[model samples]
Target: MSSPVNIPFLSFISLDREAKTPIYLQLAQQLINAIQRGYLVPGAKMPGSRKLSELLSLHRKTVIAAYEDLHHQGWIAIEPNKGAFVMDNKTKMVERPYDALVSLGNYPTQTGYSFKQSNLLDNPFEESNCTYQWNDGLPDVRLTQFNQLSGLYSASLKRKGTAKKMSNNQASIYFKEQLSNYLNSSRGLHISKDNLLITRSTEMSLYIISQLIISAGDVVIVGELGLFTANMIFQSAKANLQTIPVDGQGIDVDALELKLTSTKIKAVYITPHHHYPTTVTLSAKRRVKLLQLAQEYGFVIIEDDYDYDFQYEKSTIMPLASADLNGMVIYTGTFGKSLAPSFSTGFVVAPKNLISEMQKYLGLLDRHGDVIMQQVLGEMIAEGDIHRHLKKSLKVYMERRDNCCELIAKHLGERVKFNKPSGGLGLWLNWQAPISLLQMAKFCTQKGLFIPKNILYQNRNFTAIRLGFGHLTMEEMEKSLEIMGEYLSSLP
Candidate 1:
């Protein structure tokens, strides 16, 4: 006699299920639990759809749908010519009956992406700088040498009488000197106070430039998988987004040629130093080619050097700002990623001819930045403290970066794959296992590690994850990687 096939069971997987939990889910979890408890073993054939449907006294489609859901969640594998079988899950999870849609709105109903208004501001958790536990990747707060900043603030107030009496686009004489030197030495661009304009932030600077240069309906070239918020910002500016695909080296120049047809493009926004989330540094050969293309195409290149200071490679790669002999590149930098000072302080290095008009436009936005901030940061750069801060933080983060790689390697071995960075903060990981990152992140969060999820598109398949280790300690890194590894293994 042949052994009997075991199918999905339920506590009350019935037809009269008008409860909050759906019949399919109630049946799915029970099946998942049965496998968890070893009642259903790997390679053991599932019950025939007809027999199980008859036994459970439910429609055959429901049981089949439940099984399909099981396969979708990586609990079972359905071979082309074979029946469904249990899969190998690295981490073991305790079975629980929970509601996934507790309060969130369903997505299929809302076609395009939409935001929900909430009083999320009222969350009572007193926020300390202790936010390192989440996988959101704590930014290096060591960049905040606040005492020196306080001294700088004092000097700015002393030098400039009041906020209203602050200097024009070139905020302070104190910062102007530093700005000139920084551009000359670091970027190999000789820019004077007449050429540099102080912006409140990089996004604002981009908006100002977009408003000046790009007209509504003008084509704007950006990376296919670019920064989410920045893409939306361009859209808000009324520029038509033309996405250029990126690979290991950087943007596909050949594909860029296809998009270029006269003055169709208003500008090109790029994180050329270290590509956002994707971590691939743009190649020098292509950098030169890109400048040539910009010259030929008559489109400006907006270089956003966010976190360019943390390069662990041979030397800090210069932005196209260095090679901008024709004044087509607009260089923007922020302290948001650099020193962890999350307030207003950003600069835009543009053509000397364009600076005056930009300043005029900036005046319309805000006459000048915070006088105290401008004065103090100027003093820091002038006093050589900024360099010292960068050196110290680089060494600390490099250690954390190496530690993260080691932990991932030791625990995950060869199953999961990732490329170590030549420089910069995060790692882009590609997983061979069949899993959704959104689901994995939720599981990771339940296991006391809150990972941030950015699933841009639902239709696309997920085979990778971006693990940010900048704000984590070596121990936390090791433990998190271990937990991630265990969770991955427990998939089945």
Candidate 2:
């Protein structure tokens, strides 16, 4: 009824007349982006909706709608007497380790390495053919049997027993048993329902593990060239990451012992089944030593079996979890790579002693994952569709892996060195380098080829890059690698 209010805040919000987004959504996205990017900090009050709308020459309803959406997404909150304010610490880093990597120059140069923080991106896998391919990730479409999934989704939602369970805030009992059985058969893990905590993805499991095991200022150890996401997670937990050098077998256990001589290491995370980027299966000998170290040093071991399902040349290697005499290894495995990414189901087999605390902590963030998807996956496995799908995918990925590796051999195997891993997707190439892997990654991009930067650096040089061929056809793989190898030849 009175004159429209004027807002001094939100001065930077400019309405775009030609954008595909609606007026309110455009305003919401801009505000959320600003807050997320640290342009706006927490405890800063937002402009009144009426005032903002009036200033922008829009109706009050429009601005109110935007504010409502932001509140729902946990980006902003409103108190009874107080106006809305940005949520605290959504983008704020709880813990970060800036000192560890910075002090690399001071680290006794056993692992030839200068840590580059920019190499934090995991495999750049998307559904479309738009993004660059990194050798370490699984395909998007290979996540689940979607048609069967859709049917299960509908049935689960409509089924009488499930509705009753959902009404009472519980999941189907049928699913719990099936999930337990699936793990027991698939991974040789005889875990009870209590020991298995289901997560949307392995990343989710690691994040929960971060809360359980890692704390700010805790020391974390990983292979010299580690999985990008794990490195990021450790950093996010505010743990100092010391990269223990990895040789042909696995991470140097002797060096790890020496590095921990004066330090208090809380956790040592390893991808023993198929070490990312390098594709080195951790030797049985090293695995034994690692387990021994965990017991003697009183540190936890997180074994991430990310890609154990895709063995190209031989029998599947027994996972280190099978040898956990002490409940030290926090073992994790995912159906994301071997099956499909969308179905993103993974489990953490923790020590029976730690399971209760882990569940309480897990419940605080996300309780059990979606019941519908869980039930679907459970049924899929019980029906043998999961194993069937995995074997089919293995066939497809193996051919691609061979084609890519063979091409690399044709072009540069004489100069470069790499072990022919009996199983696993992608080739871990070692170019005993005078040429930097980072430099080659840049040149290869210009030539329409995508490869991973050499994740193996001891102190200062990257002599290798992981070249993935799983997603490409034989011809595309050959063409891309041929161009990539030629460019590497041109270097130095």
User: What tens-digit string does per-residue lDDT give for candidate 1 at 1-492?
Assistant: 113232234332333377687776767776776666555565556666677778877788988898899999988888876666667454443333332312111124554776854442233222223223533234667556777666666666776455544644344666766877876887787788777878878777887787788788988888977766567678777788888888998878778877785447778889888787677888998899999988987888989886677788777788888888888899887753556555337788887778778888888888755766766677677888777877887888888888888888898788778788876777877666556667766666667766655521233454766677887888777777777777778878
Compose the digit string of candidate 2's lDDT tens values, residues 1-492: 111122223444667778788998988887786565444566566778877887778889999999999999988997877788778764442322222222111224466676645444555342324234455545436334677767766887788777666555356345556777876776777777777777777888898899888889999999987787888888877888888888778888888888778888999889887788688888888888988988999999998986787776656677777777878889887864655466657678887667777778778877645777776676777788778887788788776776766787887767678777666665777667556566666676676665554333333555565655566777766677677667856865
Give the top-scoring candidate (TM-score): 2
In terms of TM-score, how similar is model 2 to the real structure? 0.71
Computed on alpha carbons, the lDDT of every model, listed in order, comes to 0.71, 0.71
- In the order shown, what is each candidate's alpha-carbon RMSD? 20.8, 11.9
TM per prediction: 0.69, 0.71
For model 2, where is the 10-residue window of minimal lDDT?
Answer: 96-105
Which residues of candidate 1, in runs, are more than 4 Å off?
1-138, 155-171, 261-263, 455-462
RMSD of 2: 11.9
